[model samples]
Target: MRHRGGFRCKPGMKQGSVSLSPIPTRIVSNEEFNPPPQTQAQARVESLITSLADEASRRLGVTRRDFLRTTGGMAAALLAMNAVFGRFFDVLDIEAVEAAAFAERQGDPYFIFDVQTHYVGAHYDPADAETKRKGAVTKQALLGLRRRVREAGLNPKLGGDKGTIDDLSWENFIKEVFLDSETAVGLISTPPGPYPQEAVVPPKEMAHIRDEINRVAGSQRMLAHGLATPQLGRADLDFMEMQAGTLRVDAWKCYTGSPPKGVEHGWWMDDEKLAYPMLEKAKKLGVPRVCVHKGLPLGPVEDYNHPRDLIKAAKDFPDIAFLVYHSGFKGAASVEETFTKTGEIPWTSEFCRMKRAEPGIRNIYMELGSTFGQLVITHPLICAHLLGQIIDAFGADHVLWGTDSIWYGTPQWQIEAFRRFQIPDQLIEKHRYRPLTRELKAQIFGLNAARVFGVDVHAKRNEIPKDYVSRIRMTYLEEGPKPSHRLYGWVVG
Candidate 1:
């Protein structure tokens, strides 16, 4: 876990059965950086649920579980939150049931394309994976636990390598994404390592898995990230060529935080020599959308992880789209003063301001991966500010939806939270921020990413309603909707 000798990335190759999924499971962290407060808001949600459950159950004449599944049930939950936490959600009254208000809210029509999704392979070398990697405790432990699940059908040996055995087998991912969450299309992205391909969920394997999953589903609902290591220079460039020419990657996922081996520190996006070449190659390859992993400071090169450098790159390469993952949010921060006094989030607000300063720089976009998940639970006020500020600065169409799931387990929670989340009238009126209206939410949820990634929303919209994903979900719910509400981020005590 320690970065010694100024080496940011420890080099090694990752290999296994090559199951098709998103990113490798080893990349997941279950730590809760922003645990929910136990004061008024907590008491309020509990009281609302308890009191409303009784009242709503009597009125609806249904069990708690059955009620929770209804529009009324969801409305009650939001109303309770509104009672305690102000108007953070927009929900209609229970009386709107006859009007199909609940059905309309539940039957979200947006094509949700998660720009960040990860999964580990069926197996990974133990020495390279668990021993060397950060967050190994959570990563390895979950891998061990998932192997025991009967549905995993995990081969005990997993090709007889000294590795962490996992059911990160491709099928589980499909179940989690297609059946578990409302993610219509997912762009598979991964972290980098000393040996790029050896890194968990490498580019070639991502492309292979993407093809296989789409091929299996008989639908083009998967996308792959071409891993870019600007630190590696020519080798990285060559990998880009291979990924573009053969692998046919949908976009580029760059981790300025995790530089390749032998590099003392990470490089910046505006680093004309190191970073621009990769952008140039992406442009040449015809896939100009480059997703940079910013805000989540990993390893020793924390300097490059802030996303401040992306402004220059955005201005210079107007053709290439620079998607800033995690919205430059540094985990969880107290929003009370930050939002009130400065009317800005540290890195996030700064990043948005940078975008605003250069109105012509339309290529820069903000992504909410771990950022939203942390804030939504910790404080809805923070969530409101996040949604309000980013949309206000980057525009609703520029903010993409990403859960960094399997790490957060089913993205269903985040999806439900965001769908229900609304900016309070106080914040909206005072800050003059755009309302987190349903239509705007639809754009942020998926329409934005759909356009950026070139997904045929019209075509997918028609097919998804009757697609295998929906069919399987229907049968799955009929059997019983069992959601694994697990968070894989490493929580510091």
Candidate 2:
């Protein structure tokens, strides 16, 4: 039979070369059909039916109705699969334009000051062959590291394939991630360590390295918390002071891990013999803040790495602000408890008590560096509850954002993960735990940091070009598909 579009085929035919002209008329309804002296509508319907029948006959050697039924079933099946995969689910539900407009009008403080971040000294200087070589071990660890990250609800593809010290370099570093974004400021520290195992550098060399970081931060006003290894001796302290005095560093970063015996050993925050003298020196130097590593002390010095010790120090030095890095990473334990007993644990409550007991202890801030991000992304509900408690204990103003980058890679993922939390809007508004408000975001991002460190963030902020400000969009999963299963678009550097 010949179709109305001028194609012909026989029944039961299996020809692959059959082609037909386009059907130019509108579809006809069944009611329009009639016999002799057929109207235009009737003719159109007839043409469609004939074309369908011929097409089906040519392709499947079947009747037009059969082909129509088969296609309809396939379409329905696809729709069913789409629903099962959750691809059609609208998570955010808000339109991008509406959200952007709302965010803009909120007069949200545009600048973000990341108070805690980490980078390799070698990453900024690729020519330093030694740094590059040491970085290789870090790279080798990634394959295994990525698996752990996956279990934490993060996409593994986002991590850089090659581990280079330059990945942490300030010049190449800021330009690639921080510079072009709303990240107006950053406070960087070395990756948590047992400290360098080799003999400690001479005082002069340590001072020189601190100088190099200061020079790199330059006009951008990027602040690096000078590593203070009390084990290096009075000469090292002298060198650190010169770097701090000359460079005018923002604060001091004290890694809690113990050093070699002849080197400075066991400088616990509560240890009056060790920590008190250091705090006294910081107070004398006019260093406004001190960030101390607490909890999950990765290196050989686990004995000295308790958050309570830092809490004790904070109580003693009520005048100085002490940022509790990692906020006592109770996740490793919390997760174990939950998995084993299928019940909740109260780790955050115990940690909060340490911050709450003393009056000026409100001066103590929680640096949501690696610890916060890991908990929030991996355990949203627990993180939300913990952050709420932290906010209740130490007003929201005291909570800060820290990426712990380079060692963890870009802080972008941390920011994005923060955006995804499903806490109540009221809780977000009232509680300091959710630092999403424009003013609070700005504070967490950088303003509070400026006030605490006594830096001119506004002046430094004005230095960044206008173009950079416009480009700093915090990524969200709503944007599009991510490149790797391990990486989320919101977290890419």
Candidate 3:
């Protein structure tokens, strides 16, 4: 499951159990790094959204919750963000009150293929008290901040205040990814576990879920990743063979930053002896898309998580598509101010610069999972610059869409935010960066990924409407959609 700064939802918890802000105004971590405290700008945006919702809901004769669930509510949230954060979002005042205006602005849907999404499998033990406590406040305890919060007991009154495995169950995955969001196809990914074979959601289980979802939908709507740990050497290569032959995995997901149990250091992608063999095996197996976890440092060693190694690895294996998750973003809080001042994002900038020098490293693709979700709300200028820079550096054809969802609850808000997002003219003129036009967005959203993953988007889009998943979603919407606008991750209170 997506790490949420060491917190998990309590058992028996469901979406929409408590009030939620239409747009998240606070920083929420994916447990890769500690999320910074709510900034003054974010706090102001939150306050402004609250007041706007109150006034608008009263005028419309609906509750604040009901208003926040509509497209108009999403418009109001964007408007408040623009008011506080310097007009980065494209939203209008009329769109915030008028339903038709908001609907008109949100044009036809794009082929949304989320490449980085997750959930806990059946192996996740709920009754394990230690796991529960760890899931509740592991990161805080490690950082020595919130030990008493766990001891003080879970506040069941709040939505998802309890720590349990069921919160990230398979059912929730289907509901959130398929029914709640407009995700046409999702790539089921996994985090690095002590043993790749017995992961939280092992490759076998991931494949099983993939098969089940597509089987039920009667269409290809899911893809699975087989975990690869090159530090284990031969065993890992053998495991890759089984996954390729028996499991028939779509890609090989590797976490070069996370060392397996008993290993002193993490492995590198360019390591000829260790990682190259795995890459070679993957190429031989006919699954050449090697999705690696580059940014969002996994452990105490942040050096391992940097995206520098991928340049060489990708250069060596031009046939393999190295999908770099998080786009090697160092983290939101650390880079926002720096980016605003210098127009340079941390690891991502370095990555782009490296690629510019080479100019032939087109095999590497940038995947925006937690990176986009974090920056879009906290600092849209940085978000704009980020999108602009990547498109300029790598071209729109190489930037892929990924929303490390289920941690952020549903992927819909991220999708909506992306649909309306635009790089301002000033930033465009100053940096000579290309505008985020609809055609380019369509490429980044799904077209680029479709090419990488061998998905026939035209065929898939036509098939999705007739699938069982679509039928379920249609019925669910007919019953009055109650999206839990909740962020499952930990936020600074």
Best lDDT goes to which candidate? 3
**What are the clash counts of all predictions, listed in order?**
20, 16, 2
Cα deviation at 66, candidate 1, in Å, is: 7.6
TM-score of each: 0.77, 0.58, 0.87
Kindly list the per-residue Cα lDDT of model 1 for residues 121-238, writing each as its tens digit.
4232344453234334434543443334213433332233332333224555666677778889998876666667866677878998798666544467789998888787798899
Residue 247, candidate 1: C-alpha displacement in angstroms: 1.3
1 or 3, greater by lDDT: 3
Candidate 2 regions exceeding 4 Å error are: 1-109, 120-170, 192-218, 231-236, 261-265, 301-303, 331-348, 420-422, 425-439, 466-493
Q: Residues 1-493, candidate 2, lDDT per residue (tens digit)?
A: 3221111233432211111211111111000011012234324433553454455445555554443323221222222222332222112312211335324433434566787654334334445464456446434433334334434434333243342344333332343235323456666555323333221232233334444433332334356566566665575467557756875666776766545334443567777876677777778888758887665443344545567676677778887898877666543334535634743323446677766785456568877766654554334445665667766677767877776553334454355445333455554676545544445555565666667777786677565543221222222122321111011101111
- Return the lDDT, model 3, position 92: 90
Which prediction has the highest TM-score against the true structure? 3
Candidate 1 positional error at 355, Å: 1.8
In angstroms, the error of model 1 at 229 is 0.4
Root-mean-square deviation per candidate: 8.8, 22.3, 10.0
